[model samples]
Target: MNTQMTYTAFLDEQCLASGPLVDVATAIQQHANQSNATVLIFNDQTGKQIDLDISGSKQDIQQRYAEHPETVKKVGRPKLGVISREITLQQRHWDWLDQQSSSASAVIRKLIDKELNDPNSESNKMLAKQATDRFMSAMLGNMPNYEEATRALYQGNKEVFLDLIRDYPKDIYQHILKLSAYAF
Candidate 1:
């Protein structure tokens, strides 16, 4: 079945409305749902779509961010900002790291790396398993240009992606469109 969703997503100066969506975030979400396959749309004033994880869970969202690390960390209500030096690491996180055979800093780094590595590892499992799973997702089962893809997604340039595939044969384009999880 297909999910139809439309919402008023307000970006710089206008509201874009699209429907039959699962949830309506802010006005930014309207443009996000523009393409039929876009499950998540992030309104970046920076003129880009941030890494995406449609799951909506905080951990999951963070994982998506990991697969695509934002070089320009802009502080705003938008994407639950990255953990900077100013932000204190959670105590429970520290405790979890202590229980495991790793360092808390390492854990955070892994989270970020995983987001940059595997946009699909948006969900977290048990602590240990989550780390390993993220690693594998970013490393193993990765595509020929997974890293490059991650960079493009981070850059949030759909135009570039469009240009890349613009010359593809009809068969290849159809094949790319066949993936249920893929966006434009």
Candidate 2:
């Protein structure tokens, strides 16, 4: 996991902490010591729940969760923030790549960067919707009008979605809006 990534923790419907992993862990530990409520942690960017070992002292927990440098270097230039990964392409695609002046990796990177940088791209919208949906499913599945809100989300009806979830817990409602800002 990236140490720079932010995390959010909730004790049921109430958000307990939202920040870097170490700080969230410390807050969760404190909350756990005081109450028996189950604290669920999530990766803010992906809206995915994650489990962390928070059994020891704050320093110990931080050390345990800290992002460690890879012991073995891989194929790409790690210093330049590049890590090589395998990709499967059809023979015709490989043939076209082989004829290009630039390396296959460079061309692939350009295409990927273009798609990622486009704010109105379908892929970006789909990702935002998925992230929002995942978080809603986990946190507000039982809330009133959840199904309607989900339908409105996929249909790109921001007004109806917001209206449906307006009466929900403030933290969850705000987080949904934040996650789904680009979903439409």
Candidate 3:
């Protein structure tokens, strides 16, 4: 099943809401309306905070979404903001790329965009693993079985990794799960 991007909103150290990204604005607004609290929205995949521009009216929001510029490349001269760059590759690499694709640049760009756009790709899984490591180090370094958990995470042993982190604090464990959700 396909899942929409999930966001978690926090008020101080307490979790206010965790749901689809589109619902975060309503979550934040509800939290603010109920209590004098400011919300911080975080992407569940990367654990990075996102700032929402909630000052605009409904029409302004609609206009912005309607006029959103496309970033993906089309079958023509690249996007409006695309800049040409000079890249030097080894002769063999250039020859190989030329044999595989119409143009070396296009092949390289396609490879990059493929990795960037697919969260389930191997490159992205590696990134999620790295994020899990960072989070584990910060929050679980002093906990038991840290080394074992790290090993299991890197080795892609899901059962062992889960078992190793089973005794961790609930919030930290949940955050770790969120961070490593895409790693496998």
Q: What range of 10 consecutive residues in model 1 has the weakest lDDT sum? A: 1-10
Q: List ranges where model 1 is wrong by over 4 Å.
A: 1-84, 121-184
> 158, model 2: CA deviation in Å?
1.1
TM-score for each candidate, following the candidate numbering: 0.24, 0.85, 0.60
Model 2 residue-pair collision total: 0
Error of 1 at 108 (Å): 1.0
73-131 in candidate 1: lDDT tens per residue? Answer: 57542275444454465898667778866666667678666764453443211222232
Model 3, stretches more than 4 Å misplaced? 1-6, 11-22, 53-67, 70-86, 113-122, 133-152, 155-157, 167-175
lDDT of 3 at 79: 59
Q: TM-score-based ranking, best first? A: 2, 3, 1
Clashes of each: 19, 0, 0
* Backbone clashes (count) for model 1: 19
Q: Model 3, 161: alpha-carbon shift in Å?
A: 2.3
Best by TM-score: 2
User: What tens digits encode model 3's per-residue C-alpha lDDT throughout 2-33?
Assistant: 23467776665456777775466665665566
Q: Which lDDT tens digits does candidate 2 get at residues 43-83?
A: 87688899988898988988877667766777778766787
Best by lDDT: 2
